[model samples]
Target: MTSKIKNNTEKPTSGIRAIAEELGISIATVDRALHDRGRISEKTRARVLQVAEQLNYHPNRAARDLRLNRRFRVSINFPTGIPPFFDALRSGIEEGALPFSSTLDIEFHSYSLPYDHARNSIQSALDASVDGIIAVPPNTFQMAELVRKANMKGIPIVCISTDVPESGRLTAITAYPFNCGAMAAEALFSHMNKRGSVGVLTGNLEYLNHAEKVRGFRTMLSQLSPAFSVAAVIEAHDDPHEAYQGVRRLLQSTPKMAGLYISTANSISALTALREAGRLDSVAVVTTDLIPELVPYLREGIVKATIYQCPETQGSLAIRTLYWYLSEGMRPLHFIGVIPQLIIRSNLDLYISTNKYIAR
Candidate 1:
């Protein structure tokens, strides 16, 4: 009994603590150096590693697994307006979290178009003390403050679809908005012979994504030809009724308008207005996203093209990024932009069948 007790209390040197003791460093430094995490000095890390190898130390896999067994609560905050696009995002989030369902409890917080609702949802998540957040930042200055609070509280936040660059988000998973807009402009130009005024119907330009698309569309058109000019940048606010009314007024006011670019996923509303105004067949239109509603218009050649901004992929990646960070303490890149794809009538059917959420 005496021999056994002595052996137990001897501090038998084999684990991370032993390495710390041998090097006269803290256990945290030893661990960080061993895992190659955080911002530790390379010289110290090298020393810690050398001592770990010399001692023939190996981490206990069973113990590490046990330590990581605790469940994490992650909040998903997004806006609701375009059902097809936002639904795809939700599906991607769910599918991405499926493999780790046992380890994560995902809470969804969806708000409507005013964007203040989104701000409130994020605040609620903060109050609940969620482990991580995946969100689409509202077009509000308050978003920056929310991001600051989350960062201060040691909660990582990832943005999807759009971004607030100054908000200190962990990462943004989105399409290159500028490129999406430029692609639309090119498509419209091709259909219009680069000599007609194009009307841009979009959401609030205060949002970075919307503004970027407008800027890209305008810039590309300018480069294409001086005769090709932007007639108007109409703000439909992503409202079906407002979009319908807004496009109707534009078509009436600008009878000579040769093209229309629906920069948001408000294509159906705008298209209906155009059809009602007897201008759908006349105006060469470029729309955003490929929803079932837009399929009929595309096949009939009423829409020249639609920019596909992989909303499903954005959702999946956002959750995956947050999960890896929370589980393994890995840092994700600042921005992960999904490349946008242009879909016309020819390629529309292929996307319709394979679109993950659409098929579901």
Candidate 2:
């Protein structure tokens, strides 16, 4: 006996009606089963699912089209100043968006401003009806407020690089700053044998990653070598020139400084200042992020070790997480933590290509 093949390309028109007719069930019962509404038995739902799957039935694409007709736009805001690291991150964002171009639209905004400026920018993006927002850590209060506004407006917010406490953001995608800081501290302490003073350089104190890193470094130093002391925690505001000046000031104040810890993005300046002071060889240096600016220092052994975070992954994950929430109504893993990789001269080649570290 010959059997006729069922056409799988038939479009979904009447959800409850079609299923009801095919399964010989009442429309109300089919509707309840399909939607998991009140009083739907497990057996009925299973049967409905089986029939729907066999028929290749899907939800109304026109309804979905109408719902998403506003265009799925995502806004990515990053601190400006045009750092090479941010450029890498921007490229990562583009790369991440490429695969989703058919589904979502992405817009990137760069601003060189303080906390208030970032707040205003975020508000503007929200006003523009952006479905999602991704940002590096802004000022704590501003970030918290922005996140609050976004949540109130039902827009998903993803934080990259640093986290904002009580921000109520949907997801955070960044390196494990505490673990990286602990590793840097351990490396410095091991090199110094816990006998010398170390100077710490940081960016803004309000940034969660910077603060966590400073705390982790101090904690590990105290635990591993009580004799070792953090000479000073100097704020460079993530400015290269300021970092240079801060290193100079720390060296001037503490002539016995045997190590340096850079907990932010301006490692290049610290290495430069140390080299100028002729202390590069004597002082053990550990810093965060693998930027091209730090490559010469690492290659020349001026910097003993550096921590590497995948900025590209941070950018990509932010977009992916937002899409999951908006498209599938799926929530991300709570407390997502990306591991930090410790980079030394020996294994540095694995992370860098042709002296340039591609953010990935």
Candidate-wise lDDT, in order:
0.83, 0.76
Over 4 Å off in model 1, which ranges? 1-67, 356-360
Q: How accurate locally is residue 81 in candidate 2, as Cα lDDT from 0 to 100?
A: 48
- Candidate 2 lDDT, tens digit per residue, 1-360? 111122223345576577888889988887666555679889988898788777766544224433576347788887774276686676676666554455566777877745456777788789998888888765477569778888999998888888775878887777888887899998887677548899999987887888888998999999997789999999887788889999999999999899999987688777888889999888999888787677777787778888877777776677767765776566787557778878888987778863344423
| Stretches of model 2 off by over 4 angstroms after superposition | 1-70, 354-360
Q: Against the true structure, candidate 2 has what lDDT? A: 0.76
TM-score of 2: 0.79
Candidate 1 deviation (Cα RMSD)? 9.9
Instruction: Single out the weakest 10-residue window by summed lDDT for candidate 2.
Output: 1-10
Q: Clashing residue pairs, candidate 1?
A: none
The TM-scores of all predictions, comma-separated, are 0.82, 0.79
